[model samples]
Target chain A: MAEPLFDRLALIGIGLIGSSLAQVARREGLVREIAISTRSEKTLERARELGLGDVYTLDPAEAVADADLVVLCIPVGACEATMQTIADSLKPGAILTDVGSVKMSVIDQIAPHVPDTVHFIPGHPIAGTEHSGPDAGFPDLFQNRWCILTPDKSTSRDAIDRLTAFWRGCGSDVDTMEPGRHDLVLAITSHLPQLISYNIVGTADDLETVTKSEVIKYSAGGFRDFTRLAASDPTMWRDVCLHNKDAILEMLARFSEDLSAMQRAIRWGDAGALFDLFSRTRSIRKSIIEAGQETPAPDFGRPHKKGRD
Target chain B: MAEPLFDRLALIGIGLIGSSLAQVARREGLVREIAISTRSEKTLERARELGLGDVYTLDPAEAVADADLVVLCIPVGACEATMQTIADSLKPGAILTDVGSVKMSVIDQIAPHVPDTVHFIPGHPIAGTEHSGPDAGFPDLFQNRWCILTPDKSTSRDAIDRLTAFWRGCGSDVDTMEPGRHDLVLAITSHLPQLISYNIVGTADDLETVTKSEVIKYSAGGFRDFTRLAASDPTMWRDVCLHNKDAILEMLARFSEDLSAMQRAIRWGDAGALFDLFSRTRSIRKSIIEAGQETPAPDFGRPHKKGRD
Candidate 1:
């Protein structure tokens, strides 16, 4: 299948994204061989047991040695150290990238360690489920999702093109943007939403006026929607908050200011102001659904028991 | 089949909840005849086109005449005027109820107008999708969902039992609670979540840094989940915000406080705090899923294109 884009692919962590990459790359023949690595020996063993790659190891440097493509699939917080461990072992002409949520911080952490001859491109695939770890991934994880690449001007076009092709082969549509802009965009789109979700869930949990049992029972109204995002991998999300601080904090402040205004509108019984904001937001969801980024199904197409009619 | 619960069921609105009740009542033979009313002639015509009820009219008074069960399924803001208009026409001994999200305000608005001969109970079926209007409803909308009834102590147990039976027949598990307690519980569970959803979508839409096109295209990361709740019927949510102001404001204050703490943690790079909150929130989603209030499917089981493997 198109002579396989790379001779050997090294994934430095076997969490959801790493496992997904391995499976999709293998299924679509994007790479000739897949080498999986993680800090945890148990996770490495789990990757081996799943038959996820051609080779598996707990040593990051050993896994990247001789690999034509090296992807740092660990949490953003781990990128700096992992890059340090594997920097010298990277093949001279290897294309290096990552699947972190925040782009600017990831680039800052790994770019210094990247060899001159090695291509370092930061990428983020806007796809995942609440689930994580090796068993939680599937070959179709990237299907119909966007994989954004943020490469510096010095990177060769051929290297970028090859990485784009690899992601396309794994069923992702690719886009390129400046890493700083990528961080800003994702801070609003991903990081802010995730933080808001976790915060709301925590607030609900800490409420003495309403019991947790009651919250769990009545979540179908709306709270359950936030829980899915709140249930995301802790390490990944924590790293995202830590790494994407400025943009996330900016968005959070804006959101809070708007929320305070909303609270005022509610307290003052200004139906017009409330109606206007609520009405305006409805069109955005329509745009998202029309853009094919979301399902048109009711209640996210959660299954309903058939009526006896 | 057992005898129908009511000889005539009159619904004073033809929106999502009203339309679904009409369809489910007919499908399960819970009512012998259904009479539907709405202020909007166009909505009434659409409901007629869908054959949502046995009788249709634009006059609430006409619709409730001689009805054994009269349900005000209009927005909570519209409840008082509709109740005043239909109060004289309601049949004596009839079960008069509503399906509004804010139980306390609904009770406050309609209690003074209710006839002493009629049973007045407020209910909220904790079931819905982002879609609205009569055409967007189906008979199975309430299947496996909770329907909460808030009846005053003075209301007869016989009437409550009959109404409970009707909801059960429509495939809802029923619970009864005090109107004030119901409002407080729903504020945390539904109203706050919805407001946060709308506010976040608003914040995202107003951002000059991120184009609307980019936001919509890359929404699958986490923003799309908020969009679902944000897309709900504007009139309905606005009414909810106005009627449930105290409880909603309380929850919003609590949420904002928690978010500020979270923001401080992120700004200071308190990784342990972030990780602890993220980790703790995961169990809440698990509890909701186990309570049968949510689906266990990954990504709400949104359709994924199959891999060619």
Candidate 2:
């Protein structure tokens, strides 16, 4: 329908983000060819079975060979080694990017090996479900979501524009920011929330007074919401925690301090303080809904069947 | 046709739970007449506009008079005052119940005022959305959800049975628990999660490094889930915090301790520990989904529109 942005595109891992990129790029004709690679034979075979790419391999080097665009979709922990493996094979003037959640550490890991000929732009698409793996992806995963790019001043504007256009082709709006700022913003927005979710679910699991069955039965109250985030890919989250340690730890400290204040209010029966904080937070949800980043429906519009008689 | 469970159902507040109760009870013919009361004349007027009750008043005593079922749907903090006003006006042999989130505190506040002729059974329907007010309710709010009844030994068996049947008629499965046990169970399942949510949102709001707009824009990354819980009614949550102080404080202590351990794990790059906890928490979500307390759909089935080209 239109000219493809790149002659060949290489995906370095066939996980949720990689598979989603494959489907969306192919459906939109954003690339002429797709090359998929992963360390696991089963995953590579599964990608082949799904017809996710035109060529597949277990070697990151072979996948990057002759590719004009390469995207690392693996966990952040694996980026350094994979970049060392694929660096020499990347086509001159090729665009090298990634879908890691933490940008500063990912840039720190991959930027060194990048050849002067290749543009190394780190990115993160601020969207996903709790599900993971190749089968968990869909072509529309990036639809109406923000795809942020953190490119240095030395990077080519033409390369940044091309990558931005490609993401737009895949149905995402693009924003550019400094890598350090991206890390700080996402610390509060993503990393801290995920850690809190995991921590709360773990706390509920370890309770001596409450049975696990009771927690499960009555989870519809609020715990279930935290569970969805806690159900996310463990490896991905672990890597995020390791890679974004400073910002995450800082946010966690702040959250804990605020929580202690809330605890004091609860213990002292400071109804005014509790009400003020609760009232202030309601406007934030309203802002998110108005910003088109969240659904306006109640309960995220989960289907509610008529109650049993 | 089935006979009505009560000749009159008096609801002593008309917020989300109260209005939903009114609509569901009338739709299922569980009550012959409905009387609604709220301290705020505005809320009472709104209830009348929504036809949430057959009769509406600003006085609790007037609403409970001649009613076979009197439900205190107000905040737990107001229960003592409302019960005092309506205690003498209660009909003999009538059931006096409440829908407060905290069971033990509510029982403590209302039990001393109840006459020997009246049955005092406290309940909490484990259902709601991030919305409040009379207009933010629907007849299906309690459909397929659990309504826990916390009644002492002195409560009549026949009264408990009628209340259980009435909840079933309103489309909720009913479970009986001791008030103390209900408080402890809900502390983990509901209260702690809510407080954590509020605390995190407040943390994000108070950040000096990250802008509020940035927090709102990137909320889908994980922060938005907490915002829904944080957006719950301020007055109701404040009362819950104040009334359920001991259990909530204990749960909060457990969560904070767990969080500190997680923080240590992250700071030290303990990938194995992080992965283990994350993996363990995923199964809990699966159990919740299997138990029918959560929707099986990914992202709670929020709509994902096609990306902009």
Q: Pick the candidate with the highest DockQ.
A: 2
Q: For candidate 2, write residues A1-309 as lDDT tens digits.
A: 899999999999988999999999999999999999999999999999999999999999999998999999999999999999999998999999999999988988898999989999999999898998899889988988899999999889999999999999988889999999999999999999998999999999999889999999999888999999999999999999999999999999999999999999999999899999999988899999888888888888877768321
- CA lDDT for candidate 1: 0.91
User: Which digits, one per residue and each the tens of the lDDT, describe model 2 over residues B98-177?
Assistant: 88999988988899999998998999999998888899889998998899999888778999999999999988899999
Residue A285, candidate 2: Cα error in Å is 1.0
lDDT of 2 at B82: 84
Model 1 chain A: lowest-lDDT 10 consecutive positions: A300-309
Mark the regions of model 1 whose C-alpha exceeds 4 Å error after superposition: A307-309, B306-309
Docking class of predicted structure 2 = medium
Clashing pairs in model 1, backbone N/Cα/C closer than 3 A:
none
